[model samples]
Target: MDQYSVPAGPAAGEFRDRSSKFVAALYHVQDEAAALDAVAEQARIHNRCNHHCYAYRLGPGPDRWRANDDGEPSGTAGKPILGQIDKAGLSDILIVVSRYFGGTKLGTSGLINAYREAARLALEEVTVTQQLLLTGVRLAFGYALMTPVMSALSQLGLEMADQAFGERAEVLLELPESTASATVRELQAAIAGVYVEEVGDDFEVEGLTVLVTPTGD
Candidate 1:
């Protein structure tokens, strides 16, 4: 399956009318069940609203889902919100549009337009990036080699996963599958063959690597 990723911040919008207020909630989610649960929770929190409608996509999963309208007309609230998410080519996301009733009632079309516009406006403020499958690596080396190694890493414009000091200081690094070999070669040369390095097979969504023990072949 393709990797999933999302912006770190919450996306929200508030729209108003003479008799109603609509607040759209957009969040980046990782799993289908979690996204649906979040939507349900929001609905409960805003239970006093006239309607709580939501939509979500879990990519190719059996639960790739979209729901809406709640107690309103079919395809009015939930479908439009989900449409907005699909239009943005986003998955693992849940959006709930909560409506507090005003004296006047909006027709089905009006509800659809309001929900769609709210979602679009909220998403406009988000900055999205592609998700990648990453593997982690940890390297142990002497203190004397730290400066040169760091300099080499800087020259290569590589991001360090982490650095920690102990009996033997360790440097954690993450590399994309495509660049792993090149990174290993560069590090090996920088330390002048004095470093102990290990690579793991695990994958991560973020660009940062979380260190794990390397597998013994």
Candidate 2:
């Protein structure tokens, strides 16, 4: 995919129903590791909360997603949060709803509604941006081709994520998947058609941070 939607940055919102408080937090995450970190950070800040339910959709597509109710009823908290994310047409994001039990049980449907609404509240406040679907590629070429390859990459506005120079030059790059073939063709033509190996299908792209909800609000 050349482009897809993602949150611009971290967002927060709260909803109260029948005294129960649901604080929804949404973050722009590049991978599952980042998602976990975001959740851990929330847990630290809101220690002793009733529950920390979360759902994440990572990458340009929907296949890389997971939901966890975190002790909430099955399909109650996490699924609803995920549903709201899908409804908003967002990806590469993690949305967590922390519950502070308000001395009254919300039951199944009420809990789902509260979590879903809280997530939507955060989504509404955050900015959305379209980003490229990145793909990792590794290229190794003879030392003689270094200058030309570097020149070509620079001219194409591509940056190497990692680079190694020895008897041979090896560089790892992340480029838009939609343009990978064309990029490879251009680079190969520049260096006289050398082999370029695709590293894997781990798409992680940089994201800009925008304030969705102010801290301590």
Q: Which candidate is the best by lDDT?
A: 2
Per-model TM-score, in order, reads 0.58, 0.71
Q: For candidate 1, list the clashing residue pairs, or say none.
A: 19-102, 68-78
The TM-score, computed over Cα atoms with residue i paired to residue i, of candidate 1 is 0.58
In model 2, how large is the Cα lDDT of residue 31?
85
lDDT of 1 by residue, 71-144 (tens): 88888888888788878877667788888988787887788788888888778777676565455667666667
- Candidate 2 lDDT over 1-217, as tens digits, reads 5688888888899999998889988999988999999999888878879689999998765589999999899999999999999999998999988888889888999988999999999999999998765666677767666677778788778898788777766787777766765676666554543334431233211221111111110
RMSD after Cα superposition, model 1: 7.8
Candidate lDDT (C-alpha), each: 0.69, 0.79
Clashing pairs in 2: none
TM-score winner among the candidates?
A: 2
Worst 10 residues of 1 by lDDT: 201-210
> Against the true structure, candidate 2 has what lDDT?
0.79
Q: What is the C-alpha RMSD of each candidate to the true structure, in Å?
A: 7.8, 9.9
